[model samples]
Target chain A: MKNILIYLRLGLRNLLLYPMRTGLTVIGLGIGIAALTFLSAMNDGWLQNMKLNFVLTQMGHVQIHAQGFEQSRRISDYMGDTTLVDEALQSMQSMQGGIQAWSHRIRVSGLASAAGANASVLVSGIEPEREKDVSRLHTFMQQGTWLQPGDKRGVVLGDVLADRLSVGLGDKVVLMAASPDGDIASEVFRVRGLIHSGVMDVDNLLALIPLKMAQHWLHLGAGVTDVVIRTNSFAVVDSVVSNLQQRLSGKPLEILRWQEIDPMAEQWTMFAEIYTWVVLLVVIIVVLAEVLNTMLMSMHDRVREFGLMAALGTTQQQLFAMVVYETLVLVFIGGILGFLLGGAVSLYYGEYGLDLSQYATAFSFMYMSSVVYPELTFNGCARILVAAMLGAVLAGLYPAWKASRLNPAQAMREI
Target chain B: MSDHVLLEAGGLCKYYHSGGSDVAALDQVDFQLEKGAFTVLSGRSGSGKTTLLNMVGLLDTPDMGSLHIAGENVLALSLSERANFRLQRIGFVFQAYNLIRVLSARENIAYVLQLRGMKKTERLAIADHWLFEVGLDGLGNRRPDQLSGGQQQRVAVARALASKPALVLADEPTANLDSVHGESLMSLMRDLNDRCGMTFLIASHDPVAMAAAQQCVYMQDGRIVSVATP
Candidate 1:
């Protein structure tokens, strides 16, 4: 241990002999690590935004539907009795950190016509007060107000759908759908609001109406197509789904978490995670190249010095260790500098958010917000630093080996 | 090998290839050094005095030789074993005053002791004593580049002796210095030889070094031609 410390001290002194070279190499590695850290934070922010937008705008953390209702979407497949679902939800509400909010929804495909123009739509029958607690759909109102309870003849249309129908707030539109009794039922509803959700499907095809009115029109007495539940966090969604499954066992209902509801979202998240690592790997390779270049140059410059050390009784292993220690010192300094620079920048951006408003249209299409808040966790910082050090060790090895292989007598004769 | 004989070499032969032909650098040389003796190998350039020093210092191996230092057959040791042997029993002073430029005068001397597993305080104290003994009492903190050429050589000599090795090999120790520094350095080596009984085999053709030697061996064409008491 004492001998190792002496070698380390010698290594440090040797590095100090070439300040310019050492400083530039350190800065090069620092920049690479900083880029890795910053990009990782940005990727984290983007993925978080995508996930939040997915759950808040439409899909809640967990959902329950009648067996086969999701695939069939037929009015006849609606849950005829709400007793089991209500009992399960009431039991869940009493559990610690359980469901935050839940709402029953009746969704059906229909056609709307106004001013002699018609467009296809997915009409959602919702209880306005309960839905506001479960989803952010009410916050997307662009004109007029969201649906209110007891507004039996009122309806809300997506902005694009209203445009297709040539209707606006206060205009009457006729909704037509096949009832569970095999009759084509139709009704006239005044447009109460227009929603601009930035999602193509939502903006082009959604129609919201009071649940009581939809139940009467569709002849589904006390029946709902699906129930959406919002939990405090996504982390609890799977456990909540499992609990609901157990509570509603053998009741002809399918309980699913959000990922099961939209597998594409989960896949996208996984791809983002993998992409971040690939980018970090590329950065590490770049850092490894820089470290290799610097150490080789140092070795070339100090050939005679290495020869002298060898002649002075330094072992081959000690020579190799000396070079490694020098490289490690440089890497340690660079890693800390990079962490500070990247962490500070990420913290600043995280607090204020990075404004990507120019790409708002593209971001909205991908179900993300324009303003993204970067997050730098302890684990993220640690992973990047460890990668940099590992790269340094790998880079240092070849040069250290070369130095250790020096022929002392021949090397001493070098001019 | 005898108890008084610190180094012995028989039939030492070294060859170098140049232009596809081998030239003998050390051809069938026989040598011995007694304990506490100050000896000099005097020769012209390319007469293989430096080559002999390199062999004795364990920096290079002879093509054919039975070499023993302090009763150990050094030529038979592995690369690692040779290094350990050198560290424990041999020391060297080069003509170029090849002190580690990054280390202080004291550090250069203490480095060997540190390699021997001595504690910092103990090694540094020994370094200071060697510095004083080498006439560098107040210059222990100066780096080689900060010191004069002669002072740097003094530091190198101190470094070689600080480990108290059984044999010290010097290659043209006076080649890079002027007469004044050369005489002073030779005088210091002789004084240390008498005072501490440290065995030294210095390779040099310098007159001052030859004058200070207790015994001198003359080499020509890689063979020792004569041995005389100076």
Candidate 2:
């Protein structure tokens, strides 16, 4: 170990001799690492935001969607009895460390209009008291208040939709939907609240109403889309789902997690994987190329020197170790610099977040809801460092092997 | 002295295959050197002097040869064993004075000693002693680039001697130095030969080196023409 350290020091000293070249090569590696870290952080942030908006906002930690409801979105997916929901809620409440809150969601599509504007909206009818504890929609409201029990004609308008219709506070809106009899029934609703979630799709199209009122208006009583359960922790979603399935066996009910409910979460995860691989490949190529070029040049310049070492009782193994030591030195110094630069950028963006306010309209589709915050996990950082070192070691191989295989007599005789 | 042959070679031949034809670099040759003898091999370029030195030093394996160094047959040893034998029994000085450019004169001398697994204190003491022996007492801290050609050559000589090996093979050790420094280095090698009983084999084409050796072997083409005892 000590001899290796000595040789490593010698290698480092030799690298320091060419300051400009060393600095440039390190900067190149730094740029590559920066690309990887920055993109990784952005991908993580997007997934987290999606989980917050689409999944956790209403579905809770786990959801028990009746089979085929996720694909078809029809009322036929509702299974068992409505009384079973009460028993399940009671069972969840009585269990120790199992679940925190539970609620049933009913989704309906209708045309909502003011005096001059009409747009299609997705109406979610939820239990007031249970939904508050389950999904925390109370924090999302910007104006008015939540629906009360037994309220038959109350509705909440998303902030963007309310803004487009020039209605707020106590403005009345018309909700028109087709009844089960295939007849269109229209009802005038008093806007009870305004919800301003920065997500453009949700804010422009989603509305929350009382469950009983939704049932009465759509002529489908006791019809729910799915049952969402909130657990104390999200990490145990799969375990809870498994236990729920085992307990509710022989009943055709299928429990779905967030990743199951929203196929986009899985897509986001695959995107993160592809993005990380691309960054790794590009960075490895650039770093390895620079290091290989430098090492080959340095070795070729010291042909006669290597010959002398070979002649002076230094074995081929020791000579190869010397070359490896040199490459490791380059990697160590360059990786440190790259890590510092990349980490500085990541931390800075992670803390302050990147503001896309100017291009907010342009990013409406990609859902730049708020500021873009960079996210970093411990695992991602470790992977970057290990990858950098591995690239460095591999870059040293070709040159070191060549130097070790050279004939001492012929090498010394070369001009 | 007859009972202890420091070096021996029998039927040593090295063939070089270049392009399409085979050129014999060294024909079948037999030679020996007694302990503490200063032996010199002299020839023009491509005359096999350096090839003979390399084969004897175990830097290159010879085809069709039986070689013995300090009573051990070299042909029967493994690669690592041969390396170990070279580390323990041989020291080498080159024409370019191949001291590691990043290291100081003292560190260069102590390098092989460290390879020999000597302790730091002992290596240092021996390194300083040999630096002083080669008339570079306080200059041990200077790198090779910081010194002149003669000083670098002296540092190289000090490094080779610091290991206390049984044989020191020098390939034109004074090739880059002036006549005065060359004569002084030759005298230093001779004095070490007398005091420490370390065998010396030097390969050079210089007239000064031919006159300085106790036995001079002259080569022509790829074979030895004559061996003169002076």
Candidate 3:
């Protein structure tokens, strides 16, 4: 321990011999780490946003539907009012620790006409009070008010649909679809709200109406298209699904998690993670090369110094250890500073957010938000720190070998 | 293997490849230094005085020779073993490149003891004692760059003798000092040799070094021509 402390002191003193070079080398490494951490933090925040806006807001935590509803995908193939399923959901709220908010929704795709313009869209029948707890749709009102329980003829149009139809708040629109009896059914509703959900597909193709009104027009009679349940957090979604499956076993319902229903969201997250690893690997390699270059150059300038140590009986291994110790100190200081600086930048972004809302058209189309928050996690910081330290140790290899192999007698000759 | 002999180099030969010809730097050179002797290897430049010192110091290997320090054949030791033995037994004082510039005078002296696994408190105490012995009692904290040339040389001398080695090898010990400083350093070394019975084998062309030596050997063309007791 004493020897190591002495050696470390010596190594630090040696580095102090060339302050400018040392600082430059450390800054080079710090830049690499900073870039790595900053990009990683941004990716983490993007994934979280995707989960919030694209996945949970749209798919909920879990969805239950009739067994054959998936195969047909028909609005008329709605679930019947099963006392058994209703009782199971009621029991779940009490028994399951993960259950947060849940709501029943009846969604159907059909053609709607407003004024002289018409377009195809998916219209949802919802309970206003319950939906506010289940999804973010209620908060996205761009114009006018959302549907009320007492407003039977009220309708909320996605901003994209309203734009295509050239309709505004209070404009009336007619909804048309085929009923279960194979007959064409139609209803006229006044536009109560125009919502911009920050999702291109949803904005272009979604609308909402009161559930009681939808049941009255479609003759569903206490039937719902699907039951959506939200868990407390995404971390417990699988467990919630599993527990629900056990309770609802042998029933005529198919339960699916958000990830299972929207595989694209899961795939996107995986791709982002892989991309992060590739970026981190490239940054580490670059850092290693830069550190190696600096150490080799420093070794060249200290030929006589190394020879003196060797003459004083420093062994090959001890010389190699000194080189490694020197590189470690450089990397340790640089990496820590990089982590802190990157964390600070990300924290600032997290608090104030990075606004890209100006690109609303392009970003909204793909279910992305213009405002992004960069996130930094303990796991990410730890992984980057480990990688940087390993890079430093590996960078010391050739230089340490060169120093260890020096002949003290010949090295002093050049002095 | 005599008890009085502190260092022995028998038939030591070292060759250098220069000018497309093999030059014998130390050709069948046989030398011995007894215990408590202040000896000098005096020769003109390129007469192989430094090479002989290096060979005896174990800084380089001989093509064919045997070297024994304190009756142990150190040349037969492994490369790493030779390094460990050098730290454990031998000390070196170089003329120009002597001290490690990064360390203070005390650290340079205690560096060997640290390598030998000495405790920090004991190592510092011993280093301080050696610093006082070299007439730089309170200047132990000064780095090589901070000390004058004469003081630095004294520190180098102190460092070489700090480990209490069986023999001290000095190559051109006074080549970098002025006449007055060189004479004073030589007198200090001679006093140590006389009073403390430290064995010193120094290679130098300095007349003062030759005058202070109890036994001086002259070399010409990689071979010893004569030995003098002046």
Candidate 4:
């Protein structure tokens, strides 16, 4: 350890003498690390944001929709076994380490009118009491109160939709839609509450209604779209879905998870992996070139010095070990500095996401929400640091070998 | 003592390939130096004096010969073993100082001891002792470039002998020094030889080197012409 440290000090001293070279190398490496961190954070944030509709806020781990229902939007396309719903919920409760909460939802698209203005909206009819246990909509209510058993023909409007229609809490709205038989039916509902979801589409075009009222109005009594199941961890989603599928195999039910519901989320996950690999490859190349260049030049300039060491009885292995040790030291220091710098930038951005609101209107982009926040994990930074250090040591190998291979006699004659 | 023969070479020959022709640098030669002897290999340019010194120092291998330093045959050993033998048994001083410009005088001398795996305290103590021996005791902290020619040479000598190797191989030690420093260095070597019983084999064509040696072996055309006992 002492011997290695001695050599490492020597290598560091040599590098330090040329501040510009070392600084440029560090900047190159730091940029690589920053790119990786930023890209990864963006990918992670995008996936997490998308899953807000299905994973964290809506679909717990698994969702069971009526078979063939996703293929067609018509009410007659429903193929769910309500008899199995009770059995499945019972079995899930009885099984060891099974589902945490389970509930059902009904979705319909129709026109809603308030005061003389009308607009199309996507309405979700949920069992408010049971739905609160599965999703956080009850708390998401921005004003007034969520559905109660006594409040019949009542609905909630998204804040943006209310704004577009110039309405507020405790207002009356009329909903128009066709029943399963193609007969037009219109119902007037009291806008009991308003919700703000932060998502533009959801806030502008979404409404929540009672499930019983939906089934009755749609003329599909005792029927629901699907049962949504929430588990303790997302990891158990696949196994739970498979287990539920096998348990209820004979029925015409299809189990779906967040990954299946939104493949864009899966693509976002892969983006993180690809981003990390690309950044790591870049970082490795940069640090490798840096250490290699420094060691090569140092060896070339100090040919006589190496020859002197060789003549003094320092073995080839010793010389090589010394060079490698020096590289490792430099790598360790550089990696740490780079990590700290990258971490500082990540933390700053994570706290205050990069606001591109100035270009928001110019770019014709609205999908991205306010500011882009980066997510950082300690484990990832540590892994990159270790990899950087290893790259430094590996980079020093060829030059160290070349230096140790020098012919002592000829080197001495050059003096 | 047979075990203390310090350096031994037999049937050593060195050939270099240049321009599609074989040039004999050192013909077959048999030589040995016992402990405490100051021996010089004196020759004109291209007379294989440096080649012979290199072979004895284990810096180069002879084409067809056996070399034994400190009782072990060098030809039979591996590359790493040869290197270790050289580090443990040989000290090398060159005409050009060869001190690492980045390191101070003390560090340069102590570096060899470090390579020999000595602790810093012991190595520094030895470095100080050798610096004092070379009459540059307080100048240990100065870099090579900061020192004059004689001071740098003294530091190089101190570095070479700091580890107290079994033999010292010097290649034209005075070639870069003026007569005053050259004489002072020779006198230092002579004093070290008599007082500490150190063995030295100097490879030089300089008259000063030839005259200062206790024994001289003259070489011509890669062959030894005569051995003179002073």
lDDT of 4 at A381: 75
Which candidate order results from sorting by TM-score in descending order?
1, 3, 2, 4
Candidate that would win on DockQ: 3
Give lDDT tens digits, candidate 1, residues B93-158. 898938988899999999888888888899999999999999999999999999988999999889
- Chain B TM-score of all predictions, in order? 0.98, 0.96, 0.97, 0.96
Better of 1 and 2 by DockQ: 1
Candidate 4: tens digits of C-alpha lDDT, residues A165-194: 778887888887766677777787888899
Q: In terms of DockQ, which candidate is stronger, 2 or 4? A: 4
**Model 3 per-residue lDDT tens digits across residues B118-208:** 8888989999998998899999988899999989989988888888887788888788999999999999888877877889999999999
DockQ of 3: 0.73
Candidate 3 or 2, higher lDDT:
3
Over the true interface residues, superposed, what is the Cα RMSD of model 1?
1.2
User: In candidate 1, which residue pairs clash?
Assistant: none
DockQ of each: 0.69, 0.52, 0.73, 0.56
Q: Which stretches of candidate 3 lie over 4 Å from their true place?
A: A27-36, A65-89, A108-110, A113-118, A150-153, A170-190, A212-225, A250-254, A282-286
Sliding window of 10 residues with minimal summed lDDT for model 2 chain B: B1-10
Model 4 clash pairs? Answer: A313-B87
For candidate 1, the lDDT comes to 0.88
Please report how far candidate 2 places residue B147 from its true position, in Å.
Answer: 2.4
Model 3 lDDT at residue B113: 88
